[model samples]
Target: MSERIITPRNRGFLFLDAHPAGCTRLVNDMWRSVAARPAEVLGEDAPVALVIGSSSGYGLAATVAGLARAGIRGVGVSFEKAPTERRTGTAGWYRTAATAELAEQAGREMHFLNGDAFSDAMKDQVADLIEERFGRLDHLIYSVAAPRRTDPETGVTYASALKPIGATARTQTLVFDEDGKPDVREVSTEPADEDEIAQTVAVMGGTDWERWVSHLAGRGLLAQGFSTAALSYIGSPLTADIYRQGTIGAAKAHLERTARTLDARLGELCGGRAVTSVNGAAVTQSSTAIPGIALYTGLLRGVLGGDMVSPVDQLSELWDQLTGVRPLETDEEGRVRLDTWELTDKVQDAVAERWQAATTETITDLADLDWFRGSVRQLYGFSVPGVDYSASVETDVAWPASR
Candidate 1:
């Protein structure tokens, strides 16, 4: 049988050596999304686009929705590594490969460019590729995430830190056990210093998003009525300290501020708009590394009864809203709240009681730990349903011919 490795961590990453079984499951998941919400092309005048971080999570969903539903012919820029004989391919690689295959079947143009989205050269390359293939890009989706970033212009590197805003706080943190179930324990996190806060903002804030917009606009790359959106998260009050009020929160605040500013500028330049969408929490590779979010999400699944909303659902909904079909309802700051349902009083009141009552021993009774573990497992291409895990599998997944 093919093997995997899931190590336990308090606030560390869930590690695993993935098998080909996981890849097939992911491919099925992608198809399942399209099947569930069949894509209806935006129109003959649907915008040509550029999607950053377009291989996984929200980015991948947006790409699928754009091409399959909206008929957006554009380039996808991501920093995913290619798979080798000694290891199975990265999930993003397989997802992108699957996307290319699907796009080819539809006779749509879906080009994949693997590299750093923060670099000037990568930005220029994306612009050039879009010009070469389909000139005048209209839609832009910025969904990139990284632990560290080096400013391409000034050459300043900043690494993000996940710590609470105030004093060191102790709470139940989720980790994966050897049996691949949710393991909870009490852990404390130190507050971020001023420098750490600055660094976090530098890495995760809206500077890069602004840079991309300004560059694209300066070069006359953006189309009239161009629409751009970046993904952000503002969860329930339970995680406010660690997420919304933490360093990441400060960065998001900056991101929202930038979005509003860019929205005005985009209108001035070309009858365009820029807005930030607050997404729902799920067990992504990024969320698993955070301290309290995993346990909270697991408990949330219990509160909502096993039907947790996936990133694809959120992206698909957002796509429908932003395609000029349905008007977007926004706050005074012009931020779209896709997380509204996840934060309703009904959901939060239940989660609040569970959050206070949860412990390592009582957590399983309160939350569906198995589902949480499965969610994390799926991130690393393991624990997915309906794959032949016992059979010998191919390690090499080919890059798409279109790329």
Candidate 2:
């Protein structure tokens, strides 16, 4: 494989020139990052799992890693519009194929479903397929990060905005030039209305999650001890204005709330077993799109080791909880707090103080920048080991027949 050039352009999206061998190497590297530890023993009969949005980003990678770690065979459902004039395959789609192929090589059974996850038709198709193939599903993972969604109740599609709360909010961001200097650039954002917030919540929030659970339960397809989880993030105050305090934040709050309701419902079905995981912040494609968060993540990269727990690690932890190997502890509100250790007062206080000083000071060390860049690269399939960059690659790779 020839060396592939990868660049981050306009937030979390990556512009890549890839080779098949490089892509394979990338997937292998991700698997090695969280290979099972001796302390963790998967059940002899691994449960079948389904991962919606299991084509790219944390969701796709986590789906692969979770299945592998749990020693489970499962299917992944992703929406990648291709062969429709666009003629493009989503990064997740290609990664899903790579992951499935890798799993098969290890003598595991995996399947992929490609379509719009929010569609009722797609959900029905998945439920039917699961009943036909596996007869029952033990776990479901919802890791979608779509910016726009059509409202089922209102019959209108709404797109999420990345601007700030007011008519004009200016914030400083890092602009990486050819020389890789963090040039300070000011960004201004526009405000949104109440309708937009509600609509965005309806689509991007936890409604679809609830519907999936209800549909499966209604059909009597869910197995006992079934576990489902959706990932959420709460960043620093600098990002809170645009993230946790903005329209997206409102949607996440809805997700957090909906988890409780879903937990109660699933508990009745599965004997008091269901969970929601609030994961720690790393450079994910979705996280990068949030205003001012890239800078914050970059700073965190400097403080934490460059190898801040990978999505593979997060997935392994999720599987541990799902398989009853590690019991999940909840907060007072009955939400799974995975990052409670990272979100402690001391950690937040230290990061906040560093962020305040970094804004004014000249912190241009490679060590500091590696904190962010490393995390970002790991989010995508880059900088992983065993990839042969000496050969040529293609960005347009296809998943298996099912995907």
Candidate 3:
């Protein structure tokens, strides 16, 4: 067994290390899911594709699915911090490293670019790379999440906060004690003001996504019949005011609106399609930071009869839509509803009943708290079945060799 060093960061919400065994398990598990789920058809122009923010969460899963299922030549852009002696960087870094290594073994093109996805330089770099290598893109996926953004036009930075707008939202939240056991608790967040709402929209909105489409389309880098998507979430009513009706929701409204414009623009340019997909809520590092989401996801899982899909499965379904194996199912707003099951009336009714009755003491019984906690741990590369946590792990690891 190798030596291991793991320390909590961000109040135990995050950890820093590379448990080789754990990370290897995680990578292989995702790889298996990707390879297992087959796509309905191949891509165009040797299936050259690009994914912005493709290091973790939905983006990472979609990249893996592209390589293993869609047989695409993949290019991913991310801003993951590199590993150093003091820490092993983010789990996303490790995920990309492992994925790049696998792509090399399979003799396929998989380039993972580490930089700011929102930067103009990064966009130019991607255009240049695509022009020099494959010359065209067959698919694009945007799944970016940043805490703040400095608008290019205004030179002002805006940070997004999770809070209600019209009223104070009190909801059940999850907290972990020193022992790593989760306790459901209530948190109160006051309303966000006009400035706060605008800032949140600026940070999390679709300006950058629109920017990417304009650049790519103008440069003629996207191929004909290309399919593209951006991931968003509209959770159950348990925390609607704080999520779907709050600051983040306002940003999402912008995103969905942007999607409509992109859909038409892409169709004209290359007969392509673009839509913002409403994905189901799951345990992501970003989502965990939200106040009421943990409690909601917990109760959601229980209400849904213990069925929970990861980013892997969700993206695979998107792949199915892109490939025409499964037809698109859209809501009245014209947004794709890949979160088909989560939006079912049966599930929402059950969740509403459970959430109404759930207090801190009863939350554990009402929801899948154990699974929720485990999923959170899994995001940071802990709680895997075979990882020897006691053993020291290598902290200073090299980035994956040429993808």
Indicate which candidate wins on TM-score.
3
Candidate 3 lDDT for residue 56: 80
Q: What's the TM-score of each model vs. the native?
A: 0.92, 0.87, 0.93
Error of 1 at 83 (Å): 1.7
Clashing residue pairs in candidate 3 are: 3-391, 3-392, 3-393, 4-391, 4-392, 4-393
RMSD in Å for model 2: 3.5
Q: Model 3: per-residue lDDT, tens digit, 1-403? A: 2235675344656654545456667877887866444323343444788888887888888887777776668689988877765566678887778778776765568787888887788889898888887888878889999998876667788899899989999888777777866677778999999999999988888888888888887788988887788889988777788999999999999999988888888888889898888888888878888888887888888887557667777888887777566787677787888687887898888888887887767877898877777777777777877777776676555666543
| Per-residue accuracy of model 2 over 1-403 as CA lDDT, tens digit each | 1123344332323533223444466676777666674543344366788888887666866676775677777778888644122223445555667788887776666788887788778878888888887788888888888878765556677786664455556666665655555655567777777777777787678988988888888878788878888877776666677787788878888998888888887778776455567777766667777667777766665666544566667778877777887777777766666666556677667666666666424556412675566445544545545654444445556568752
Q: What is each predicted model's overall lDDT from 0 to 1? A: 0.78, 0.68, 0.79
Candidate 1 per-residue lDDT over residues 1-403, each given as its tens digit: 3234323232235453555457556755665675333445544455687899888777887888777666777888888767664565677887777788777777677788888999999989888887777778888999987999999978988999998877786767777655555567878889999999999999899999999998888778898889899988888788888888999999999999999999999899898899998888777767777778888998899898745666777776777778866787787778988887689898999998998888766888998877776666676666678765655666577776644
RMSD of each: 3.0, 3.5, 2.4
Rank all candidate structures by their lDDT, best first, as comma-separated numbers.
3, 1, 2
Weakest 10 consecutive residues of candidate 3 by summed lDDT = 36-45
Candidate 2 has its poorest 10 consecutive residues by lDDT at 1-10
Residue 207 Cα positional deviation in candidate 1, in Å, after optimal superposition = 0.7
Number of colliding residue pairs in model 3: 6
Better of 1 and 3 by TM-score: 3
Q: Where's the lowest-lDDT run of ten residues in candidate 1? A: 2-11
- TM-score for predicted model 2 compared with the true structure: 0.87
lDDT of 1: 0.78
